[model samples]
Target: MPSLVRAASIVAGAALLLLAPVARAAPAAGGYAALGDSYSSGVGAGGYLADSGDCKRSANAYPSLWHLAHAATEFAFAACSGATTAQVRDRQLSVLNAGTTLVTISVGGNDIGFSDAIETCVLGTDEDCTDAVAKATTYTRDRLPADLDATYAQIHHRAPNARLVVLGYPRLFELGGCFPGLSEAKRRVLDRAADFLADTTAGRAGANRAEFADVRGHFAGHGVCASDEWIHGVTLPLDESYHPTRTGHAKGYLPALTGVAP
Candidate 1:
């Protein structure tokens, strides 16, 4: 695990600075704000904070952990479960202002029906899983780019001085394991879907002059079905299913952010 984090940090030195056509410096870390969906809100990490209500922001979530690690002038945790890019633009951006120095966001999955696609892979046949993943891949290629561009533009507009970091999800499953869960084919497709999501996100982040913290390498060997899993299976509070565990936030996400954070 330590090796994984170190490798990721080394890789992020160049990778995280880049937007594809341009590179930007990491933000001044003050008056921080976190925004986006369940990944950013910390649904799977557990230890829910009460004040966030149905949003279920977790004490162990990456944002809280990040705030605890820094001495920012102010902090706002506005991410929520099931939030789409539009939802984030409409509801979460209120936390941003000219004084906001750094922002982290993880959204766009819900808008492409990530949960439903996974449901098909989990409960349906291989053909169903392939179809679901295919549709999602197409949606990401054809539709999500425009939506992400708009959302990123809005975030920059709202917080002109903030350094924005767009965080990408990790692959959820290991290639082969002893577990009797989804078939190898399904796992392959699902992992491909994650790749598509991450690639699209990185592209958009670079286009907007924001940094992207890719966690895939950091979480590589600890996905579901691995000997030491960092992602949840079909767990209770089903919303947490297929999301990162607390270890993922601390070891995977924290290090990934530390690689790019100023």
Candidate 2:
């Protein structure tokens, strides 16, 4: 009876040793680093984290929501409100390294005078809005691509193993809304600008061998003019306008980010 028990224990030890290699070969948990502008930082979503300060890094942002869904080995949230591509390259890229496995960036809108165009549409004359939209389109065509390429190159160099996802901006207005202040013509202009930004951003993402989130139609039924809007209209605090609401981040951007399969 003693000899039989010894043999059984030896067999169990051998089986455990054989399975050890298989467990070690399994994939590890992700390491995520979030970067980019106010869109990524949750400027209008409100309830900013205590230590976030001017970055306005909200607990409800898409990156934060995505982080909640996936438990990462290393998580760094470096996105800031009012950040441009240049700022991201200079300030945020330092947080990422070769070990990073997942990254999300929302940029390029600020580079082409996004806020100026919005202001012109809201306050300036119809002709001024058209001119601003036209200029923004032209800028997107000529300059935005190079800016994106430089930034993407830096990110690729820093986090060589990361699966980078570049998120696009959403169209702010809908066809008709309860407010009834903004003209459909102006809406079309801004809509075209948004489309141009998405196209440019997608092109750059493809160039970098990264995924593009393409958030164009994600906020379709819940634009700023919708009955139940996901985006904020002109708020008293100028920075809040044209930014996503908490619902927008959850329903719009979070799904888009998750679709990339971290």
Candidate 3:
């Protein structure tokens, strides 16, 4: 009887040993991958990671913040500043795999000529700004849907198991305290553009079974014009302008993503 009991105990031990590698290989939870543009890459947040270079990935980005908060996950920060939908599909999708349990993206602003629109609104005449914004609005209404859908499909293909979260652009201005040269009327137009972008993005996210992380109200009262602004206001070295500040990442983007990141 004693010999039989010893043999059964050994069998159980062997079974546990065999399962150990499988358990490690398939983490019961936690594997995160971040992909997208300046917002996700921390372009305006500063403190850029040396290895990321022109991508301008920053340690203060929401993805990094998420990873820091949830250390158990296998985190991949593949987002880059100024990335468009095509760039995300071609360059960033490689980071995801079957094991990726969570994914987040903030893109499309670049795809619709976001920088040009901003330039027009801030530096050009009212008519020029209006025309540029009108064009952008048309592009969002027409061109962005297909592009966003394709990108969402690609993401789903790469990380079939991951829960995708798509973040939208925030309205950069408030009704008051306009930037030095940028007018309130132009800012309102810009705000409308932002709304269009967010709406388009949210629609795609829904179709793709992904969560849309709406940043509209999250950034309320913290726009570039705010007394304690979270977003940068027409800074030098072009790259720094109109991007989120570090505090923006911490308080705004981080909270928005965290609320639905997983």
Candidate 2: segments with Cα more than 4 A from true spot: 1-30, 177-180
**Taking the tens digit of each residue's C-alpha lDDT, what string does model 2 give over 9-98?**
433332221011100011223388888888988888988887777777889999889988886456788888767788888878877877
Residue-level lDDT tens digits of model 3 in 86-198:
88887887777888888899888877876677765555677888899899888899999999999999989988998999998888888865535467888888889989999
State the lDDT of candidate 1 residue by residue for 158-244, as single tens digits: 899989999999998898754567788898899999999999999999999899999999999998889999987666555577778
For all the candidates, what are their Cα RMSDs to the real structure? 10.5, 20.6, 19.4
Write down the worst ten-residue block by lDDT for model 2.
17-26
Question: Mind sharing the TM-score for model 2?
Answer: 0.86
In terms of TM-score, the best-performing candidate is: 1
Which residue pairs does candidate 3 place in steric collision? Answer: none
Error of 3 at 251 (Å): 0.8
lDDT of 1 at 84: 80
Judging by lDDT against the true structure, name the best candidate. Answer: 1
RMSD of 3: 19.4
